[model samples]
Target: MPPRSPAEDRAAADSDTAAAGREQTRQRVIEAAIGLLEREGRDAVTTRAVAVAAGVQAPAIYRLFGDKNGLLEAVAEYGFAAFLAAKHVDPDPQDPVEDLKAGWDLAVEFGLANPALYTLMYSEPGNATSAAFTAGMEILMGRIRRLAAGGWLRVDEQLAATLIHATARGAVLTWLSLPEDERNPALLTALRTAMVTAVTNQQPAVRDAGPAGAARALRAALPEQTTLSSAEQQLLREWLDRLAADG
Candidate 1:
């Protein structure tokens, strides 16, 4: 074989090494970005800092995630996917209302379990599993439709779903804002009960015709003698009333 040129040989080796370096840098950038987001919240996620943390040049971030929005989108997607994976709830399609209640319980469990990730996925800016959130809204509507079909929902199916989602989100956000000590034991339990009462009419949630309607609906949903005692019911009702009064 003819002797290869030294420059050509060096050039080929450099290109191969550059390709490997690119991938390593990309992964490093992604990891650093996620860590920064987790540790400092969304505002701390800046390109320069991410690059420094990743030990790569700032431009590498652009190459990897395209832009700040792109990086945010990636984080939201991965964050939510991870959240859903970590949540081990099995939705029962056959009994969707029960499954939805179970899912809501699981959501609170997941939120309390991983507060940072949960907040990032929901309240955190640009930190959303867009696909999952959208799908969840659809599922909520479908469930509302089911309730309507069964004569459980007495209000607009669509509007009812939106309000319930808002209430659940607001409840969690307010709880997160409270001092840990004040968060109180059984808070989620109370909140869940309130939410169920606010939305359910027949042992499951249903649409409400008015503000007090949800609780009354909830009362009607349960058999005359129900699992919740007067005290527990009163507390949940109070919680629901407070939220309702504020709005």
Candidate 2:
């Protein structure tokens, strides 16, 4: 390929700058929409209201987000991104099971803290397909994979993920629906424990050994396996370290 001329180089640089500016503006608008949703309710997140809050014209909202529904989707994505940021997944947690509990608690606490945002992100099934939501699912899947590799999983990976999500979602929404006087802390604990029992095997898959021991064996033999790719082996190794520490 021929080297770019000065004019072409300048054009490329200008294009990058413009793209960055657009992304910044998009973030500002999403933030404005989130603020409105949290403070004044979802109905208050009108195009006019968001435009005023973001200091942009209504047409800019349309130009950037396409329509009101699109703006709402962006708001949902922002909520997912925020939740993902708060989550601290330990690549090598000492106890994978305990780590799973902690992760579950964090998600529930986030929903309780941000009910409006949580509702917006999860009330409809469509939001599950958003980029941010998919990213969060990937993190959950990693955790599930760790459980499977450690011989702690009772169900298949996909079923375990579904059960975890369902339990958490049910717990949060049910707790929120109850009257203040009827709300009980045990509800959350019960749901979490139930989820653990439903998805995880109390005894490790290997006889005469527990999860930690099983994890070590798997870690040692992981290199001999050909099913998983190189990147997967590296990640599984980290999880194995955590499980071995538990032993």
**In model 1, what are the clashing residue pairs, if there are any?**
199-205, 199-206, 200-204, 200-205, 200-206, 201-221, 202-221
lDDT of 2 by residue, 1-247 (tens): 9999999999999999999989999999999998998899999999999999999999999999999999998889888989999988887677778888988999899999988889889977899998878988888887877776667776656677999998988898898889999999999999999999988778666565776657755864675689999999899988977876575
Give the per-residue lDDT of model 1 (tens digit) for 1-247. Answer: 9987999899999999999987777667767878887788778889998888888778878988899877767666665655556554433356646655766766566566656656766755445338766655555665665554443543444456766666666667777889988987577677777766666565433243444445434433433446888898777756654543432
**TM-scores, one per candidate:** 0.60, 0.80
All candidates' lDDT scores?
A: 0.64, 0.86
Task: State the local distance difference test value for candidate 1.
Answer: 0.64
| Runs off by more than 4 Å, candidate 1 | 1-28, 86-95, 123-129, 203-247
Number of the top-ranking candidate, with TM-score as the measure: 2
- Candidates in order: C-alpha RMSD to true structure: 13.3, 6.4
Top of the candidates by lDDT: 2
Candidate 1 residue 52 Cα shift, in angstroms, is 3.4
